[model samples]
Target: MITVVGTGTGAPLSPDAGAALAGAGLVVGGRRHLAAATTMPDTAERVVLGPLAPALDAIEQYLEKPADQGRVVVLASGDPGFFGIVRALAERFGADRLAVHPGVSSVATAFARLGLTWDDAVVVSAHGRALRTAVNVCRAHPKVAVLTGPGSGPAELGAALRSSGRVLVVASALGAGADSGTGSGASTGTGTGTAPDSGSASQSGERVERVTPAEAAARDWGPAVSVVLCLDESRVLSPVRTIAGPPPGPAQWALDEGEFTHRDSMITKFEVRALALARLGPRLGEHVWDIGAGSGSVAVECARLGAAVTAVEKTLDGVERVRANAAAHGVDVTAVHGAAPTVLSDLPDPDAVFIGGGGRELPAIVTACARRARRSVVVAMAALDRVPAVRDALVAAGLDCDGVLLQSSRLAPLPGDVTRLAATNPVFLLWGVRPPARDEGVAQ
Candidate 1:
């Protein structure tokens, strides 16, 4: 059997792990892990993991030996099952053939050091993945723990969140390291892990630093960062939650037009909003844009569906209404007071976009949104003349364009409690989706 040990997070090997290590014929781990393994038998063949495939190959070769020859041991940090090497190993060698031992995750350790409970907090991994998903999650959620990697470390995360009003608690060298000092910035603390003594090598060099997004962006926090906690201090301590990870995408979406505050009854009808939302496909860890958001009905719905939404309005009153609507819905939405095509440049590119109003500038607005949208763009218009231009613009941006003219009639209360079919104004709903191959080519 291959014994997978989780260490490097202040937890020493258990008796079972030690016994397996002693009998290990092939030991696979990182350089630091191998160096710290004073108990590893000298007869064992060591494989320092560089690329994952080669280490997995070595393990496979060693597993072919007879059970009486020796067993295999793979050393990993924290919980091997949590975004670690266990998945890779299990894929190559069946899960039943291996034994996994877990330690406290870096996310858990970081939160523990701060006296914070993380059952309600969202945890995202930026290691070997796009930082945009982590950044977008941080932007939408109140508390999030980001596992840091080489290029997607604290500085990169901070740069993305500088204007997001988030406090970053960067935990560096959570277990053993060369230097045992505090991190740079405000509110620095040094503490040892759960070891018996202060000088224990396994628990030393753990430092936690709290800084603003701007502060975190300004420094080069060398290669020792374990996790970064992005928090909105105001909402750090959330009410006790029965469930975890983003509180389950609002019970219902496509909320009624009356739910939002708008002037002159100007709002996207529920039917159109429903189709727009379907085309947008907003979800957690993604960003969505609502351009010309008069009432922010679409934006609020997108936010309710668990996306980081930005609403751009030309009128100041419209912007205020958008913010108020988002507040009433208990979701986060950034309301920017400016016209579409122009203000969109200042905002980050979104995974999807919704255009509600633009008048004569509808084509230009659609062009801008289509070019920047990573996935899809949905446009709703009352004027039928704008459809051709918008389709042309989407086609110019290399998106597959499709549209439908929606004419719906709702049941209205007539005299004597009788119901009459009231015909609602027809709306043109158009959507453009980027091809999967093309979307993969873009920088996420």
Candidate 2:
């Protein structure tokens, strides 16, 4: 049977795990883990994991040996089941053929070192994956724990959060060199309790430091980092959560225009926003850009729907309005005080984009957004003259273009006490979705 053991930080193996290791014919782990395993049987075959395929092959081959002879033990960091190696092992060898011995996860150890409870915090992993979504989560949530990897570690995360008013509690190398016999990993300089030391900011040893986003962005944090906790002290202990992690999406969207603070009726109406949001399909773990955000109503609504949102507006007043709207709704939106088509170059490519106001540069903005959007782009225009050009821009970018005209009427009471239908100005809504890529010469 294959046994998976969690070596939690630097904690020593438990008695049962130790017995398992003693009887193991094959032991597989990282170089650090293998080096720390002094109790492993001298005759045990060792496999240092670099590329996982070879070790998986060894496990499969050894499992095929005579019954009761091949005892394979795999050592993993923290809890193996928590975004760890357990999933891979379970998929390969049936769950029935394996036993799991879990230790504390790195997230748990990091939080413990900080003396904080994380039920209200959102936990995301940047290990071998994109850091954009993690950065977005930090923007939207008050407390976030990011599991760091080689390229997406603290320095990268800190730079992204710069000037965002969030503080980063960087925990590095938790339990790096501490003797497992004492049941404590390395000591974080703070003597708060029994929690092990998360590593130092320097690559040489273990340490923990809490710094503002701007401060974190300016420093050089070594590569030995483990996890970084992004927090907004103002909301640290949020209203006691009945459920864990980020709260559920807002009960309803397409809120009325009166909900936001706008100047000169610059916000998109609820009627149009509903349709545009439907086409955009904002949801968790996705990024949406609202170019030419007037009151940022669309961006705020998207953020409320659980997508990471960036609102780009040129005017200083418009930028302030967007920030205010996002704050009123209690969601995070990165409001850029710059014009689109020029500012769009530095922002990460979006999953979806909504162009609400771009004046004469509408076509260029639509082209830029459509080319980079992974899913769809939606544009709202009041000027009839711009419709054909916007549609053509999306079409030329290889998107399937669609459009509709929306005209709504509200019942208003006249002076005579009779109701009349007051028609609102008509607007043309245009949207496009990139068609799936096809092989050469394939039929449409």
Candidate 3:
């Protein structure tokens, strides 16, 4: 039988775990975990996990030995089940062959150290994976915990979030290292895994440093960092969540223009926003760019629908307004203070884009957005003369183009209290989707 033991953030092992380690025929774990273990039998074969596959194979081989003599114990950091080695072991040996003893996860420990609750936070792991998605999650959520590894640690995360207005709480080595263990350092079968009353590991030398993104990026946090908590301090304790993680998408999107602060009347109308949002099809894990963000109505609405959104506006006032509007809605929108076409090249490729204002450069902006958008691009234009050029740009980019003129009239109360239709300005909404390669032949 394989027993997977979680070495909680520097906490002393429990008696049951100690006994299991004492009788283990083979112990598998990282170099640190093995070094910290005091009860492992001298006869126990040790496998340091440089790569997980070989260690798993060793466990399988040892388990094949007669049941009378084989007892394999695998040690892992924090809760093995939470983005840990337990899933792999369970998959290889099946759940029936293994028993899991979970310790407190590092995420739990980090939050405990901060004296904060995490039911409202989104937890993501950047360990051995691309940091882009984790970065995007931080941009979209107010509270997030990132599990760090090798290249995807705090420095990388901080550089990506430099202007995002987030604070990084870097917690390094919550529990004492293995070299600090003060037992006989000999294998004993008593299996009493209780920690010392002095609690040296739990109380001393554990570092939890809080820094802004700029501060975090300026220096090395070293490899000892266990986890980083990215928080927007303003929203850190925002109303307790009845549901955990990111709250559900706003009940209704395509919010009214008055809902956002804008310069003059330069904002997408609710009717146009509804259609543009439908075409954009924003969702979780996707990125959407809103060019010429004006009041950032489109960007704010896209974020409300669960997409990581960036708003590009040339004017400083527009950028501030976007930031204000996003904060008002309790959503994160990266407001880029620059014009499109030129600035768009540096931003991450998007799943979708919405061009609300581009002046005379509208067609060029549309071309750039179409080239980068993986899914769709939607453009709203008030000048009728710009529609053909915009459509041509999308078509030249190998996209299927479609559009509609949205003309709406609101019911206004007349002098005698009778209602009359008041016509609003007309807007041309043009949208494009990249046609499948197979459909190109038929279209041609």
Candidate 4:
């Protein structure tokens, strides 16, 4: 059987792992892990893991030997099962053929160094994945842990979050001497509670440096960086929770018009908002644009649904109303006071967009949003004349357009202790979706 041992998080090798290494016919691990393990017998063939497939092949070769020949052992950083090599090994050589030993994960070590609890933090990996997803997560959530890879390290992350008002805790060289070398192992990134002291070093040679997003972007934090914690200092410590991750999204969405502070009955009705939300599919690690956000109802709801939202309004009072509604709902939304089609140029690309009130510039706004939108775009219009132009704009941008004319009636109390069905105005809700293949190819 192949023995998988977790190491490199300042944890000593367990007796079983040590014995397995000593008796191994073949050993596979990173250079640091192999050098740190002094107990391995001289007869064991060492394969320094650079590319994964080659190492798996070597392990397979060793396994093919008879029972008396010897065993194979693989050393990895932290718990091999938690986004580690165990899955790869198990896929190549069946789980029953391996004995695994786990160690302290870098995420736990980084949070421990900060003297904070992480049961509420969102953890995402930028390892061999698009960095935009991690950036979006950092923008949407108050606390986040990012597992860094080559191109997705601290500098890249910081550059993306420079304007996001987040503090980054860069932890490097976990469980090593003061002069440790760097490797391409797992790096845990997250946001934590308590103000960072900055420039703190642990006895194990782990350097935990705290810097603002701008500062982090300015410097090159070498490959030794094990983890990064992105935090909003204002809301670092959340209330006690029963579940983990992102607080389980909002329990209720498509809030009533009365729930928001709007001027002169100028908010998206709950019925229309519900359908728009369904088409938008806002969630963690996504960005949404609410154009012509009069009362900012749609923007606030998108933020509440766990998406990074930017609300655009032409009037100053409308901008304030958007901000106020967002504050009232306890969510973050970037309220931009400017006309659509023009203001949207500066903002980041959105996964989905909701265009509320664009008058003469409705088609231009829809075209701008649909062209940049990675997934879909939803447009709500009260005037029937704008419907055809909006649909044409969506189609011009290579989107599959679909729409509905909604007419609803709600119960209204009458003077004689009775209720009457009050018919509301009709609205045209139009949405355009990009093809899946095109969405996957989007750079942002």
Candidate 5:
């Protein structure tokens, strides 16, 4: 049978945990982990982990031994399940063949030290090829704790967040490496995993508390926490988990302007937006750029269809409002916090582009959209004089161009006794499509 042992807090071996090492005929673990089990009666034959491949081979060799011949104990740090080697071991051997004795996981200890409730936090590892998933989760959630390895450690994460104006608290090396005011931004005492309650260290003493991302980055932080401070709070993804999703309901959207909190003269009218969404035809596996995404109605609708979208607008209030709208719709649209044509550089390329507002930059933005868009570009113009220029820009970029003037009449009360048709201003929707050369020639 395979017995898993957790070296309690990585300091002293508990009486019960120490006893696990006494009669074992085989012990498997990292060199340092097994070495921490010094209290064993020295009757155990040790198997050291070198390069990963060799370690797996050693574990397989130990499994070949006859049952009841001798006991085997595998040493793991913290809980063996939280980003540990236990999963691989279980996959290799059936669950019935092993018994696990866990140590306090680093995450539990980290939370305990912080004295913060992490029931709503997601635990992820940045030890792989990319930190993007962890970063994305951080952007989507209120709280997250990332386990670090080489390359994509705290510094790397901090550098990536520097773009989105995010703040990070890098707590490195917990337990032993927590000393010297390094990773955690404070020097911690050698005591075990529980919090000291003061929330911070005074002078030379160590404890748990909040520290600035800059302060955390300046030190040689230990294996610790990467606390992400959002560009804004709404970016947080709720930390609740469920076995399944809720039941579906009618997709009642394309709401009127009165539903949201928007600035005067800043909302997209539903009629115009419906046409834009119909033309955009958002779907999964596609990316769209919604320029001048006021109220973010188009972005939200497209994202609701599962297409990844990015909204670009000028005013900070407009940008934040767009983000709030997108979040309310439960769609993933990166609400860019700056003006388009300038802020569009950092974004990923798009498959489709939509322009809602502009001045002289309108034609240039349209041209850029045409060149960048793999399929199509859509522009909504408010002025009649600007249409010729926008249409010319699209056709100049070699796209098939079309335009429609949309004028809607709202029903409003003309007198206390009767209602009349109140016609609103006209809007020009000029669309451009880059059809395949074969199809383009077919029209001839």
Candidate 6:
């Protein structure tokens, strides 16, 4: 039988897990993972898995030789089922061929130490890649915990967040050096509080505290073992009971033109913006580009609705305003300082695109939007002359184009104890969607 064990750094072997590893004759794992299997009989062969490709090749070679030669033990960190080596091994050898064991995950211990609930937390890893992906999530999600690695460790994440005017909490070495070590090999990403600190973030911090990687390894963290980051630390409202999850209240999107802090007459009218946003349909798991985002009301609103949003605002003033608005609403929106259609090249392909400030560039911007957007594009225009040209651009891109003339009036109290129709302004909304390929259409 093949047994998998989690060798949590600072904690003792769990009863069941110890039993499994004790019976193994051959053990393979990362250098750190091998610690738990070290106490096995001297006759057992110990192998270190690394550089992944070579390690996997060696395992396959051994499995091909014989089964009864010896029982094999594979060691993993944290919950092996999660982004762990178990994925690689299971894929090659098949699930039925293995008997698994588990431990607590980093996310759980981190949150537990902070006395926070992780059900709503967005957990991501920046172990080997650039920290951009995790940074983006922190920009967007209120409660996020990022698993850090060598390059993208605590300090890097902290610096990125500090520059963005966001506050964060970092925990390191959660299962190591702590009396309550991390649980990594578990099947689930949760942990039960067995000691006094169990289950409550309040008490958990006492048993397993949070620290930066530097602090944990610095001889100062006492017994802390891992990092748990809170993106918006300044806003953690002390009697912080509720999740404050998914924004504090209702959405007040599509605000009037005058609502934004813009100087040079660059605002999308309320009516037109409403139509543009409807066609765009922003939400979580998708990306939207608010090109020429003036005050960033649309981009901010989309982010609050859970979409990963990027706002390309050319002017420094507009970028600042967008940042302020995004923070005020408690949503993460990236207000990039650049011109778009030109600047759009580096970003991930957008699911939706909105052009509110692009003038004669509307057509080209629309074309670019069509190419980059997987679903739809929406453009706003005040000049009647630009409408047809923009519409034609959409049609030429092979999209079903549609346009709307938006004229809205707010009821105002008149001086003579009466109500009046306060006509705001006239604007146009142009939306388009690409027709599915004829040959590749879904078969009925």
TM-score, per-candidate, Cα-based: 0.91, 0.90, 0.84, 0.91, 0.60, 0.64
Kindly list the per-residue Cα lDDT of model 3 for residues 1-444, writing each as its tens digit.
Answer: 788888837566777887888898899988878887778888889999889899999988888898767489999888999999988988888988888888788899889878899998889999998887788888888889999999898888999888888888877766654321323222111111122211232334456778778777766656667788999888888675789887887889888888999878989999999999999998866789999999999999999887899999999999999999998987889899988899998898898999999989999999999998988999999999999999999999988999999999988899987999999999999999987556655856
Query: Residue by residue across 1-444, what tens digits does model 6's lDDT show?
Result: 567776553456677667666776677886646654555667777788867787767666667657666677787766778667777778888888777777677777666656767666677777777676676667677677777666676566655555455544544444543321333332212322122222232224323433333332322222232444655656443343466334443456777666566566566766777777789988655678899999888887788777779899989989999988887776778888988778888676777888887776777888888876778888887799998888988888778998888888889998989999998778888889867666657674
* Candidate 2, residue 172: lDDT: 69
The TM-score obtained by model 2 is 0.90
Instruction: For each candidate in the order shown, give its overall lDDT on alpha carbons.
Output: 0.84, 0.84, 0.84, 0.85, 0.65, 0.68
Local accuracy of candidate 4 as per-residue lDDT tens digits, 1-444: 889998887767778887888888888998878887777888888999989989988877777788777788888888889888999998988999879998888788788878888888898889889998899989888888888889998889998888888898888777764111222233333333232322233323566677888777777666677778898878878899899888887889999999999999989999999999999999888999999899999999999889999899999999999989998988888889898898888998999999999899999999999999999999999999999999999999999999999999999999989999999999999999998773667795
Error of 1 at 117 (Å): 1.9
True-structure lDDT of candidate 2: 0.84
Which parts of model 1 have CA positions greater than 4 angstroms off? 177-204, 438-444
- Summarize candidate 1's per-residue lDDT along 1-444 as a digit string, tens digits: 889988776666778887787788889998877877777889889999889989988888887888887889898878889999989988888899889988678888889888989988999999999999999999888899999898998889999998788888888767654211112122235532221222232244666877878777777777768889999988888788898777777778787787888899899999999999999999999999999899899999988887898999999889999989988988789989988798888898999999988999898899899999999999998888888999999999999999899999999998998999999999999999998873657786
Model 5, 1-444: lDDT tens per residue?
777876534344455555667767788886656655655447667878655566667767876878754677788767777677778777877777777777777666666665654555567677765676565544443456766666666556655444443444343334443221122333544322233422233234433333333433444434333222222234333445442221122275567877665777676788888887777766544678999887888877776665657788887888888878876766557788776687777775677888997787888788878878877889998899999999998899888999899999998986678999988778999888888767545656
Clashing pairs in 4: 144-190, 145-189, 145-190, 146-189, 187-226, 188-227, 189-228, 190-228, 190-229, 190-230
Report the lDDT tens digits of candidate 2 across residue range 130-175.
Answer: 9988988887788899998877877788888886788888876677
Which regions in candidate 5 have their CA more than 4 angstroms from the true location? 8-17, 41-43, 48-51, 163-167, 177-209, 217-219, 222-256, 263-290, 297-311, 315-317, 320-341, 347-444
**Order of models, best TM-score first:** 4, 1, 2, 3, 6, 5
TM-score, model 5 to reference: 0.60
Worst 10-residue lDDT window for candidate 2 reads 190-199
As a whole number from 0 to 100, the lDDT of residue 274 in candidate 3 is: 95
Off by over 4 Å in 2: 10-12, 178-185, 190-205, 213-223, 411-420, 438-444
Q: Looking at candidate 2, what is the lDDT of residue 263?
A: 88
Span of 10 residues, lowest total lDDT, candidate 3: 184-193
Clashes of each: 0, 8, 2, 10, 13, 27
Off by over 4 Å in 3: 178-204, 383-385, 398-426, 434-444
**How far is each candidate from the true structure, as Cα RMSD in Å?**
5.2, 3.6, 6.9, 4.7, 9.2, 8.9
lDDT (C-alpha) at residue 226 in model 4: 75
